[model samples]
Target: MTATAELVVDAGRRIAQDHPESPLAIAGLTVRYGDKPVLFGVDYATPPGAMLAIIGPNGAGKSTLIKAALGIVPKVTGEVTLFGRPQAQERHRIAYVPQRAGVDWDFPATVLDVVLMGLYREMGLWRFTGARHRKTALDCLERVGMRNFADRQIGQLSGGQQQRVFLARALAQDAELYVMDEPFAGVDAATERAIITVLKELNARGKTIICVHHDLATVAEYFTHVLIVNMHKIAEGPVAEAFTEANLQAAYGGRLSGAQVTRLAGASS
Candidate 1:
């Protein structure tokens, strides 16, 4: 097998042996953006091979929680462990997919080029993309059903295609854990379905997946675990149990209309 394939297999084996009950364990995690507190004393654990959805209203710190867990954001106080190690120590085992809006789509790069960037950690900053890297990039695209568009410029693709390309890049990293932010935003139904399929496949392979989601309609269908948050963690547990009217009220602060609450509760059922 190729080095990339071997790495993936080894990670999979480690995941199987460890059977890490939690991909991320946060205790008293608090993040502040300048003087304003974002995440307040958040405590949660994301289990392996489970799809955990972080849901809340705008400025609820869902994204902040993910960033704090990844060590990308400065935390006021708290501890975050990934696979029982500091996030920096286990960086290779984790992958991240930021929202499409967070990227500069105007950059002059092809889909293949973008996906190949995932190899940078293994390839090193001074190294160049070689034949093996190219092959791996192609395989990543193929896994996402985007191999045919490898040569297409990123800016030329539609929003959904761009999202898929980003996902392909993340997959190419061969990580054990995936943290995605707003992955289903600005996509067609087909794209959403495709993303869901890939997420399910990844979970089945023993990879942990966490998504910062907005749509209240698909929580039950797409997520096994749910975390409702605003400035602090409101509720977290199995989707069927955690996504309740009371929890929504707490997260939304009585601002969510009764009809909206009913809709969310019904959909989560």
Candidate 2:
């Protein structure tokens, strides 16, 4: 086996023997663009049912970290496990929501059609979606308050509406763990509230959630745990403990200010 593969095997065994219930565990993860390293030996273990917020500045590899762990982007060296198994072995147990700007809104798919795509894994490659699939897709849309837009073209919707559609799609997947990249980016107040409510509900139902969050102000209010990163992990643990001014300074190089923290807290309330 490759060196990276061996690391993954060792990490998986260690995690199972130690943190057996951790929903997500990443160790010695590294990523590179050509020769430039983006993430270097990042490590984190997320507990089940926790709302995790990944906080970092631009170009800090926040999104890259998630993509690498999920195998959406190639990793240079790392070990990643979900529920004590390798990611490939537990693909169906995890759901990913990428940045909204990454999607081609002009794609010729309806809201319902996009949501139904979440079920493709369960449906297999050869089977067609039937009435049951449609119903489930519609129900997922309802949860996100986007059922009314079911038949609408995705490109015709507002940014928040488009985000809700994507959330519906992820919900339709019904995975135990959700990994999202900036779900709050560019969304309005109402949309943010709606998404948070849905996220809380999911957590209450025993799902683990990890979101790449840009707004540090809302970190304490929106997440139970925080992972501070800047190319490499700075700090990670309970929001009450790890989301401190000292850690923020270390991660963002003193960019976060006292006023910014107050504003973020006020915004969440």
lDDT by residue (47-139, candidate 1, tens digit) is: 767899999999999999998888888887666778877678888988899889998998999999999888878897668889999999999
lDDT of 2 by residue, 52-157 (tens): 9998899999999999999999998777888887789999988899999998999999999999989988797778999999999999999999999999999999
Which candidate achieves the best TM-score against the true structure? 2
Candidate 1 deviant stretches above 4 angstroms: 1-21
**TM-score for all predictions?**
0.90, 0.92
What lDDT score goes with residue 154 in model 1?
97
CA-lDDT, candidates in order: 0.86, 0.87
Give the poorly placed runs of model 2, Cα more than 4 Å off: 1-17, 258-269
- Identify the candidate with maximal lDDT: 2
Ten residues in a row with the worst lDDT in model 1?
A: 11-20
Model 1 RMSD, rounded to 1 decimal: 8.9
Clashing pairs in 1: none
What local lDDT does model 2 show for residue 247? 73
